[model samples]
Structure formats: structure tokens, C-alpha cells
Target chain A: MADHTATSGTNRKVCVEHLFKVFGADPADTIRRIREGAPKDRIYAETASVAAVADVSFSVAPGEIFVVMGLSGSGKSTLIRCLNRLIEPTEGRILIDGEDIVGLSADALRRLRLNKLSMVFQHFALFPHKSVGENVEYGLKVRGMAARERREKALRALEQVGLAAHADVPPANLSGGMQQRVGLARGLAVDPEIMLMDEPFSALDPLIRRDMQDELLKLQQQLRMTIIFITHDLHEALRLGDRIAIMKDGRFVQLGTPEEIVAHPADDYVAAFTRDVDRSRVFRAQSLCRDAHALSADEDAGVAAERCEALGREALFVVDAERRPLGIVRHRDLERDATATPGDALITDFPSTRGDAELVTLYGACATGLPIALLDDAGRLEGVVEPLEVFHWLGGTGAEGGGAASSGGEGEATPASAAPSETRRRDHG
Target chain B: MADRISDFYTLPLDDWIEVVVKEWLVPNFRPVFRAVQWPIDQVLGGLEEFLLWLPYPVFVVVVPLIAWRVAGGGVALFTLLSLLFIDLLGIWRETMVTLAMILTAVTFCVLVGVPLGILAARSDRFAGLIRPVLDIMQTIPPFVYLVPIVMLFGVGIVPGVIATIIFALPPVIRLTNLGIRQVQAELVEAGLAFGSTRRQLLFEIQIPLALRTIMAGLNQTLMLSLSMVVIAALIGAGGLGLTVFTGLGRLDIGRATLGGIGIVLLAIMLDRITQALGEGRHAQRPGLKESLTRWLKGLVQGSKAYNERR
Candidate 1:
């Protein structure tokens, strides 16, 4: 496994390129029509075929949680299954740690699955006859590990999921949440470098679903496993995905960070999905922050007041030599002490927050009606979250177009659709 | 109109069947039929000798003990009393021989049927090929094949057992196929996703879950074999079946009734035990000692109540 990783100069854990999975009698003809840009419905009408996945491509870096979100029939499940060749793709390449697995022999594919990748299913498919420990150890057993060693490793994996106590019990005896934990333990036991999860929490109750999501995040933090999570829940995608790809009709509509997606949805379908999302929870301070206007700490208070008045701002940020925020200098204070340096009258107690803080958490800081300094690591002023900007983002107004246009340039590293605004306009009409 | 319809050239279906069976099958398949009978003969001979050699007291104790373990005290008592009555009827040897035949047929049925069932469950083409064959084997009257069987293998115990096996084989195969196929597709996918080989998937996941259904098939096989015994007796197979066959030939109603009674007793005992096994109740049943203690306590209490009533 390490040798494969070493051979792959790129750091991507898994990469799929131009993958297509057409379910029909004539996949070649259907694929040809699909490549010719025929609509899925027309293709189906013409060839009597369903293109479950079409021209899909994305790469997940090591330790990144790449989420593919779509509703039923959007082909998210097919796309995930293609990663393991469970449903063999009709076209293109799937490179795992730089090794193209699309052409792997059956035995080689099995070995790859045993050593490098493990899948967690939507239904928590624990073998009913096996004990929880046995279920967890199934992958290791398939890998031909010694029985005692596999059992020990299985127990350890179960312990990681807080299910060590239930190891000896049959999986049927566990509650839904506990059974999914065993499913998770089963995946974990193999210690796969990449874990493919197909809506692992979707079958769970709402409350348990949230708990499982948190559990998965916590596990990912420790394990740093490259996870490609599939879900139909937009909220779940936003909560768990470091980068999210929204799919429709077997094609990806947009791919970006949760904040980017919530702030600047690429098309109307994506916009409609984002419309229901709680922006305060998804859009962080960094995404909402505006570039702060600051004066050097040694600048004159009179000059600062003049600069603030010229800019029509209520206050100005004061920064030291490294661009680290010293404090804010209010216009009134600068005017009151016009003879002194701006730093002398700086309000050191002004509200501030980290750039990564969610907008929900900055409501109190925003309540001060002052620009909240958004600091990055080392106390540098990355940007400022203005009170108006918070309301603008939370209000779901049309002011998002400018933000969307600005982030659109940097949001995707892949060759995503270029005419998002055009598509959005067309959809709106 | 009916005479005209009948006057249309008659297809000689019966003559064709006779030519196929007598001239073609008997001459060509005699060796194959003998080979088929070889395993049945060995198993039947061994079982019959052991059952005959075992003391009556030990057989009486052991069979009821098995029933007690598998079922409950009521079944155990029924088994014990039935076997003792068969002995009192002076047909214990005949009963053992019939039991041996039934056991041997069922054994062969499982060995042949299970792999075929697994194959049917795995492949649609194989299943399609075998489905009509299984249907014919099941729906055709048992007596229809006896002549062909006797022509091929001759009149003897092995041929009789072979006929019983053919009559009993379909249920096990059909049920085994249904059981394995009915195992949830998700479980099979899980097995594959976890990198289990096809063999491992069948044994580790499919067979274990399908065991109860397979056991139901076994019980059906046993019952069908029991029903075939009297028919098998027409071919000179020795057992209680012989007793019934001879009594029927001579119009000895008393002898026929006694033989029928003995067969029914044996059938009831075996059916109860196998059915209990199929239901998987054996795992939850109380131990024999615990059941005996509880029964004794119930008997004592019953006597006290009876005395008070008197």
C-alpha cells in the first residue's frame, strides 16, 4: 500500500476521471449519445438506457472528506459503487493511490478491497448470523489474517466506536445505532486508507443520525481516513463535507466547500438546495468577512479620522508592523484625540472572532454594531465581519451574485461547468 | 363432431413411451441405475444391521431421549410408548428395517439435493433448466416410475430404497433452493463488499441463515420417504411395509391394521422430532433432567388433587 502511495507522486488518495456507468443493453451506443450531449431523458427515449453516472470526475486528497450529495436517481450511489468496481463503470479510470483499478483483475480487485478500501453501506449490512466481533473481523478474515489476531484487531476497532462491550452479542441484538457502529467498526478493522460510505447514517433516526454524523467526524479527526461520503441530505453534506459535489441527472452541477456552496450555489438546482440550508451555520466568518481598512499604529489620529471620514466608515482598524490587529480606532475617539497617535485611542476591547467561526457564533459579536475583527492564526487581521454583512448573508437576498461571481473563480480546482451565472439565469427564467 | 375429432390420426403416445422405457432406457441405463443404487445399498445395509443388532432397551431409551432433547417431555413420552407398542405388536425388526430405509433415502436426498439447490440459487440458467424437471419429479404419481425403476434395477431392497429416494428428493431440493435464494440480497452484497469468496459467502452467510428452511425440507423428505415405504414393499423390500403388503394380498385385515398402526406410530414420532428441529426450538428446550423433574412434580400434584376429588 505504501509502495503504491510512493509511486503516485500526486497526494490524491482517490481520483475518478470521466467515469460513466450506463445501465442498458447497449452501453457503448448510450455512452456515445451521452458524450454527444444528449439529455438523459432523450438518451433513455432513444436508446432505452439509463445513464446512471455520466462524465463524472473528481479527486479526493488524503484525509479530505469529499461528499457527493444528490437525491434518489441522481446516481450518487452508482458513482460511489464505481470507486470499488462493485458496479463496474462503463468508461474511464478510477485511480486509487495512483493505481488505475478499472482494469484490475478480479483477484487483484478483491485484494485491493481487502487492503486499501472498505465500504460502509446504507443499511448497515452486518451479517445476521455473525457476532458483532465477527462482523467487525469479516474484512480481516477475508484478508486471511490469523483468527486470534483478527479477533484482537476487531475488538480494538469496536473499542474505537465504543462498541467493545457488545462484541460478543449478535448484530441483531444491537439497536440500529449500535448496529451501524458495528458496520463502522467493520470498515475500521481493515484499516483501509480510503473509506467509502454510502449514506451510512441515512437509515438512522433523525436524532441518531446527528449522533452518528458527529461520531463519524470525531472518528475522522483521529483516523484522518480519506472518506468519500454519499448522502441525499444537504444539511448532512454541509455539516460533514470538507468539499461537496452536488449532482443532478448523473452529472455534477457544482463542487466546492460548504460555505462556497451555501454562499454561491452554481445553478438554480443548487440554489434551490442551498435556499433551505441555514446559512448562519454553514457560512463561516471567513466567507462573510470583508477586507478591513486599517491605519498603521503610528499614524496620526487626525489622519485616521480624516481617512475614516473619507471612506465614510465609522471606525478604522489599527495594526502593527506584522499586520496583526492591535485594536480598532473609532472615528469619535480619533477626533477626540486628534493630536495623539491612532494607537493611543484604540479601543482594545473591541469585539473579535476567529476567521473560521461560524456566523451563528458571531451574532453576539455582531450585536455590538461594530466591525468584528476576523483574526487568523497568529492574531493577524484576515478580514472583518461587519454587522450589515451578517444580516445580508442571513437575509437570503439577491446580493449573493457578486459574492458568487468572486468565489466562482477559485471555488473549484476541477473542470466544473463555467457558465454558472448563465445557468442560474436560465433556470430562473 | 366428436367422432370426426377422434378420427383425426391418433398419436401413439403410450407406444412411444413403452418403446422409450423398455427398449431404450432399460437397456442403455442399467449400469447407471446400478451405480446410483450403490451408495443407497451401503448406507441402507449398514443402518439396518446396526438397528437390528442394537438391544431393544437401548433403542427405546435412545430414540425417546433424542425426542426429549429436540422437542419436549410430551413428545418423548409419545415416542417411548409408541416404540414399546410396536415391540408388543411383534414387529420391532420390521419397524427398524423401515426406519433404516427412510433414513437412508433422506440421507441421499440431502447429499444430492443441497448442492443442486445451491447451484440453482446461484445461476438463473441452471434454475430454469431444473425447474420443470423438479416439477415433473414432484407432480408425477409415484407409481408411474416404479415399473421403470424395477426394469432398470430389478426387484430388491436397493431398488425399493432408490424408488423411495426419487419420490422424496424434490421437496428438499425445492426448499433448499428457496431458502438460499431467499437470503437477503443485502447480506450477499455485504459478503462480497467485504471480499468474501463465493464459497465463503455460501457457507459463512447463506447456509447458516438458510439452515431452518433446509431443515424444513429435510422433514418433508422424511415424511415423503415414510409414505413411499408401502409402495416400495411391492418391489420385495423387507420391512413393516412387507407385513402390510402381504396382509393386503391375503385379505388379512387384522394384520394389515396392525402394520398400519405401527407405521403411523413411527411416522408420528419422527415427524414430531424433525418438525421441532426445523422450528429451531431445540436450542431453547429445557434439558432432559429438568423436564423429568418438572414432570414428576406435576404427577405428584395431580395424584393429590385426584385423591381429594375422590
Candidate 2:
């Protein structure tokens, strides 16, 4: 009996307000009590409540990445489950579009989940007895999709996730990453409006996690579906979230863009959380450079000097003949040598990063205050190293590194630089 | 060879416990249960229950209903023919009495076993504690259990039911524990996260999810009860089983065969229906049917809109 009743201002899809769920003893009765204003402590005392999810509320815009992050028990998973009433709320209301879904019948809620919302479980929850195609078509079968249509849709979904090749295989035969892709395809098969992922890639090796993230980004770009992604990995959250909500003890401690969260953390918990973050790796140089005009690449020194003399524009990107970035030549780096030509004293700094590397590794790499080079395939540079620019991007005091930023030494551009490799094995006892 | 065959069929516990444990226990816990038990328990349980309950009246109604639901009208019609053959042999009344005996015995089993199952499921220690007893209950020959039941409860349907409860209760209890334990841990967590009271989680998610397995146990119990109910007729229970036993004593193959037919009919029906209901994944998923089901008086304001929109 989900209230499908339309109201002018309320969202018609799904809304959950101040929902609380406690296990043991007629949970619906607990919700009834809570609506009537039962104290949480008393509710706990009476029902042996675990307080899985406390009063947590966040709206998902139509096409944004809203991530919920927390440790294993933080109730982030519970909160997401509450959205579709897959997990019923002990207290409060969930509105879908504009409908209060808390009271939805199991079938209605399942239909809603099937038609409008799809979730990927941490364990993948693929029916072990079903083939990949059958698993993907489960919701369609439940929705009464004809065999041909559902098969076509399932195959299409598999294709989107690059798993059409494994359509007939049992899910268990595949690796964790492949299984997760199958899970992703399963979630996408129904063409759900909101895709809810419960730590979908947490089980994958680091390398696979990044690939899956990119794959998800690509899908999100194509589908423009609102995504509520859950993860405990901070970097994963920052990598994918348009906005992230950090949760603890069944409560959201902070909610903001990764930039705001990294620079001005709400409190001690958030500050401690972001203590080791490498601002350079995460923040873009364009968003950071205070004197963009002064950074003249030595390769472009003559051109910049001509511009500065004429139009007072002091900086320019130093580049090779093919427009590959070497580094930035400040007025000083150029003035230090009168013999310096844009050719003779070309800035040797190579391109640094896409500014989306994992902050933990980037922090370690940036400790020497070196601007790590960013490169595309074929080893060509795109921009100057901006490791020092990260501190400024973080909105810390605009202090340049005390030493000259080192140009990136020769290093193989491996997936390791992005995230841990999928095949990165550890000895198990 | 004749002596050895007779003795083999009736070996005492001294010669049997090791065989039971080796043949039943180890494989059921480890590598392959069905593979091991196909030649033993399941086959034995099926054959024994069939032999004991096949000719009873309860089997008649049950077999057709089950056939109707699962195997469809053709099977139902086929099933009815086999049953009326027993009645044409004129053991219908006695078969009805045997059905009563099995139903009574099963009622007693459920009464004692369900709570025990629930208790064991709720407590690890209790479940562990019952493991040995359940195993022993399943392994010991039916006669050993009957002797004590007869001494304590006296001879009749009451004593028979008591003995049947002792024999059949373990499967239901064991399966209940197994079912509850088998419920996905995440579904329980979902229940908890949903603010489901522990009770609600147990009743709604845990119990419902565990139902198929639990139903399997119930089916086993019903089967065991029906099987044992006829044997209990030996001690003056006088059901369809009594007719079969009596016919056997008088060497009247017609009467014995008719009685056997009745019990088989009942077993088939009850087995089919319970399994059909238990295996149902969709039957229980609640939703639009309620929207379709006209509520008394009228649809709620919320429901009315749901209907209009749909």
C-alpha cells in the first residue's frame, strides 16, 4: 500500500524521512511507536534495537552521483535499503518521486525496485542456480516481460557491461570482477531510474575496482541515471561521487563535494579522516594556480615575453613542436638565463596527472614535493606536473614548495598508479 | 542364508549404531548426502512410508489434490483411478480410520516438535545439545521407541501418536533449526536495518525464508507419522493399518493390498501439496493483489489513488 497519492510539491518517486529500523519483535509495531514519538532509548530498551540506521536524510537529484560512505556497520547500507523498502523502516517515511514508500506492500515495493530502482548487493546475490542470462532476466520475468524481449534486454545489458560473451556461463565460474560486472549488468537490465549499489566493487582487486568505476562512470554518462553508490573506500568515493556523505554510528557526519570535504573538513573526525590526503593528486591545477599568467614554459618563453611586453600576459605553457607540455617557465626561470630561448631553455616538466589519482598513494608520491608527470598512451605529455599545486588546490596557504618541484622521473604508467592491480596477490594463511 | 537375511533385517543396536553413523551421519554432514542416502535414508523413508501409509483414506484425498496442483488434471485423474481401486476392494472405511490415525500422530508430532525447533533455532547451545538426540532418534529402530511409548502411554491411538511423535518429531525439529540457520544473514541484517523488531524479523523474514526447508521437515514428519501409524495399529489402534496387518495375518492379499493403496494415495497428495506450497517464491510476495482485492467497505485514500493511477 505505498501511497502513490500525488501531491503538487512532493517528489512522486521515493522518499524516506527520519526512518528507523530495529530488529526483533514485530518491527512494524516499533515504527508505529516511533511515529507516535517514542524515545529512541526507550525504543531500544523495549525492542532490543541495534539502531542500524538513525535519522538520516539525503535527496538524490535526477542525474547525480550521491555516495554514502562508512565502515561495515555504519548503517549506510541500511539507509539505502530503506529507500525502496527492500528493508522496511521501523520509523519515518520514504517518499519515492512524491510517494511515501514506507507503507508499500512487499509486491509494490518489489515492483518499484524492479521498475524504478535496482540494487547491486555486496555479495552480488546472483542466483547460483541461474545462468548469467537468466539471472539478468529475473526481474524482467517477474515484470512479465516476454521471453524474447527480456532476453534481448538482458543481452543488451550484458553487452553494455562487456559481458555479452559470458551470457550463458554460470556466475560462479567467473572472477569476482567479472561477477561484479554481471551484477552491474543485472542492475541495468530493468532500465531502473535510480541505481543503488551496495559496495558493488568492494570485493574486487584494486585494479578491477578502478576499471569498474570507470565503466560505471561511462554507463552513468550514457544513462544519466541517478546513482546512490555506497562504499567504505574514501578514494573510491572521491573518484566517483558528485557529492559524498560520510557516515558513522548510523548518522551522516558530513556531506559535501570532495574539494570542500578535503580542504575544510567539518570537525575532528573529518579532519582526521582527510589527514593524509594528497591535495595535489586530487585537485586540478586550473582550479589552483594563483598566477596562471606568470607560468611561462621555457619553450614558450619568446612568445610569452612578446605577449608580456605587448599585453602584459607574463605566463605561457612551454611545449614541444607538437604541443606536448614540458613544464612551466616562470619569469624568473627565464630571467635566470639571458641566453634562454623558448627552445634553449625549454621547461623539462612533463604533464602530471588527470588529478584523479588515489590520494593515499599520491600523498606518498608527492612527499618529495615532486610534480608527477601525467602522460597519455605513447608517452606524450599533456600538462606540467602540479604536485605543489595540490596544496593550493586544497585552499591551504598559497605557499609554494620550498624546493624546486622535480619533473617526473621516468616511470611506467601502470594501473598501479591509478589503484591496486586486480592480480595483486597476497599470501593467504 | 534365510537366518542371516532375517537377522540382517532385525540386527540389534550393538551391530547397527556403527552402520547407522557410517551410512547416515558422516556423509549427510560432509561430501555427499543424497548420493550416500539414495541407497539408504531417502529411499528407505520413501519406501517405508509408502508401504505403511499407501492404503489409507487420507492418502486418497491428498494424492489427488497434490496431483491436481503439481502434475495437473491428467495426473489427478490417473491418481484417482489408483485410489478407487483400493476402495473397490472394499477397505475404504478402514483406510479412513488409518488416515485419522496418521493425522492424529502428525498433530502430536507438530505440537511437540515446532516449539522445540524454534527453541533450538534461537539458541546455539540448545541446537548443539539436541544434535545427538536428534541423530539417535532418527537412527534407532521404530520398535525400540514404540516399546517405551507403549509402556508409558498404554495401547491405542494415544500411545501410537506418542510413539509416532517420538519417532517423527526429530525431522521437523532438525529441519526447523536448519531452516532458521540457513536464512541468509544479510536478510536478517536487512530486517534489523529496517527497524524490524527481533520478533518481526523472526516471523516475517527469518521464518518465511526458512519455510521451504521447514516445510520439507513437516512433510517428512507427516510422512513418518503416516508410516508409523499403521504399525501402531498392531497394538489395537485398528486403523487402515490394522486392516492391512489383519489382512496379512489372515493371508487375505486383497484386503492388505487395498489398505496399502489407500495409504499411498494419502501420502502422494499430502506430499505434493505441501511441496507445491513450500516451493512457492511468488505466492508470498505481497503487493498489487491487495490493490486488486477490494478491501471491506472501500479502498483507503492512499490505495484509491494507487488504483486510479494504475
Best by TM-score: 1
Residue A57 shift from truth in candidate 2, angstroms: 2.7
Over A170-219, each residue of candidate 1 has an lDDT whose tens digit, in order, gives 78888999999999999999998999999999999999999898888888
The C-alpha stretches of model 2 lying farther than 4 A from their native spots are A1-50, A90-93, A103-108, A291-388, A391-429, B1-181, B185-223, B235-310
Q: B147-245 in candidate 1: lDDT tens per residue?
A: 878878889889999999999998898888999999987788778888888888899889988888999999999999998977899998989889999
Could you list the CA RMSD of all candidates, in the order they appear?
Answer: 8.4, 17.1
Label model 1 with its docking quality class.
Answer: acceptable
After superposing candidate 1 on the true structure, give the runs of residues whose Cα lies further than 4 Å from its correct spot. Answer: A1-9, A321-323, A398-429, B1-24, B281-310
- What lDDT is reached at residue B203 by model 1? 91
Predicted chain B of candidate 2, TM-score versus the true chain B: 0.69
Report, for every candidate in turn, its global Cα lDDT versus the true structure.
Answer: 0.85, 0.66
The per-model DockQ list reads 0.48, 0.04
Candidate 1: TM-score, chain B only: 0.87
lDDT of 2 by residue, A265-365 (tens): 78888777777765644444322222222332343455556654653333345545555555544455556665667656545543354323433344554
